[model samples]
Target chain A: QKEVEQDPGPLSVPEGAIVSLNCTYSNSAFQYFMWYRQYSRKGPELLMYTYSSGNKEDGRFTAQVDKSSKYISLFIRDSQPSDSATYLCAMSAGDSGGGADGLTFGKGTHLIIQP
Target chain B: DAGITQSPRYKITETGRQVTLMCHQTWSHSYMFWYRQDLGHGLRLIYYSAAADITDKGEVPDGYVVSRSKTENFPLTLESATRSQTSVYFCASSGAGQGLISPLHFGNGTRLTVT
Candidate 1:
């Protein structure tokens, strides 16, 4: 199995709805968990990140990681059409070098926020 | 804003041709990376450099070459283009941190098509 796994979802939701995206990994060494948002024809940008396990929040976005279960999630509160984009889960297993061996990414989940 | 730039935002080449994608960053980050995004594959690491003259292979490195002769530039070259090599490529940079968990700054990306 691939190191990381995620559902390729074209999840459609109405504006103001709450959206939850998830990913699971088989590797236990992944220490840094990140969420990236990618717009069409654009590069993925870091939206939120967490270290080891626990929760980190930024405005309407919240990221949670459970290293024990090898699961990570991103939740969007009061979503909007402006939030429509592909969400990718990325993690790294490296030393102090930062992103050593690069990041292992899961197939992104496509999200559409309807107006 | 990252100040990371990629050249030839769009490229088209035939099989057996050689093509180069350029990446440059102004932050002088200690780490640089190359990743390719394909359908159902999210973003896959092609190659990365921790510093000038230090490079390593990621998940998919075959048929590709990278050189980090300078601290701010990381170029990816396709030795012999194949239809399978057609994908959107992104260049990213980051600072040194434990577990390499620092946020990655990515370029707009280069779209290459191999006919």
Candidate 2:
């Protein structure tokens, strides 16, 4: 089984709808969970970061991590067309000392916010 | 802020040719990372450096070489590029990359096509 698993979705939602993206991991060692947004032909940008198991809120985005189930989720409130992008989930096994290995990423979920 | 920048936003090269992607960060972060993003594979770490002259390989490090002659620059070179080497490359840096709470900043990415 892959270390991280995320649905590669082209999920379409109407404007102002709430969107939720999730990822599952097989490794329980991951201590930091992150969500990134990538526009077409662009690099991934850090959106939300959560440590261990908890909920973090930033602007209209909220990230939740449940270490017990090895599941993490990102929820978007009042989504807009500008929010259309690929969302990638990543986690590390306690940073692995200066970013050497430890990070495993999901395939990313493609989201489309219709106007 | 021009935090991190990558050279040659796009490139097209022939297979077997040597290609180098340059990464520069204005933050002077102690740790820098190189990652490749494919259509379905998400992001895979290729190499990383904790400081100048200190570099290490990551998951998909084969056929790739990295050098960190200076803290602000980490370049990745493909000695003999293969068709499979074609992907979008990203450079990232963090203040406390060895820990669990540092926020990572990413470059705009470089798209390389090996023909």
Candidate 3:
């Protein structure tokens, strides 16, 4: 099985709706969790990140990580058309010598916010 | 600008040809990485470098070569390109001494099509 699993969803929702995207991982060593937003033809940008098992909130976005279940989630509040993009969950487990090993990414979820 | 940038935003090459994708980062980050994104496969690490002159392979490194001669540049070369090597490539960097959880900054990405 893949290390990380995420539904490649084209989930469509109306504006101002709440959207929840999730990912499940098989690795137990992952300590750093991140969410990235990728627009069409553009590289992904970091949206939110959390360490270990906890919740981190940033404005309309909230990132939650449950290490025991190997699950991570990103919730979007007051979604807008501008929020239509692919969301990818990435995780890493490395020492303090920097994260040169890079990260393991999920298949990504394609979210569409209708106007 | 003070961010990572990738060259040859779009490239088209024939099978068995050699092509090089360039990545430059102005942040002088201690860690640099190369990843390829494709449909169904999500994003997979190709290679990564920790500081200059230190490089290592990631999940998919076959048929590819990388060198980090300078701190700001990490180039990926296809020894002999195959149709399977065509994908969107991204370059990313993260700072060292950030305590194992530094966020990654990614370039705009390079799209290569092998025919």
Pick by TM-score: which candidate is best? 3
Q: Tell me the whole-model lDDT of each prediction, alpha carbons only.
A: 0.90, 0.88, 0.92
Compared with the true structure, what per-residue lDDT tens digits does model 1 show for residues A23-113?
9999898888889999998888989877899999999999999999999999999999999999999888765424545788999999999
Chain A: TM-score in each model: 0.96, 0.94, 0.96
What TM-score quantifies how close candidate 1 is to the native fold?
0.95
Per-prediction fnat: 0.64, 0.41, 0.67
Model 3 lDDT per residue over B6-92, tens place: 999999999999999999999989899999999999999999998899999999999999999999999999989999998999999
| Complex DockQ, candidate 3 | 0.63
Tell the DockQ for candidate 2.
0.47
Which pairs of residues have clashing backbones in candidate 2? none
lDDT of 3 by residue, A25-74 (tens): 99898888989999999999999877789999999999999999999999
In model 3, which regions exceed 4 Å deviation?
A96-98, B98-100
Give the per-residue lDDT of model 2 (tens digit) for A31-60.
888898999977788798788898999999
Model 3 residue A85 CA deviation in Å: 0.3
CA lDDT, candidate 3, residue A110: 98
In candidate 2 the C-alpha lDDT for residue A36 amounts to 88
How many Å off is the CA of B52 in candidate 2? 0.4
Question: Which is better, 2 or 3, measured by DockQ?
Answer: 3
1 against 3, candidate with superior DockQ:
3
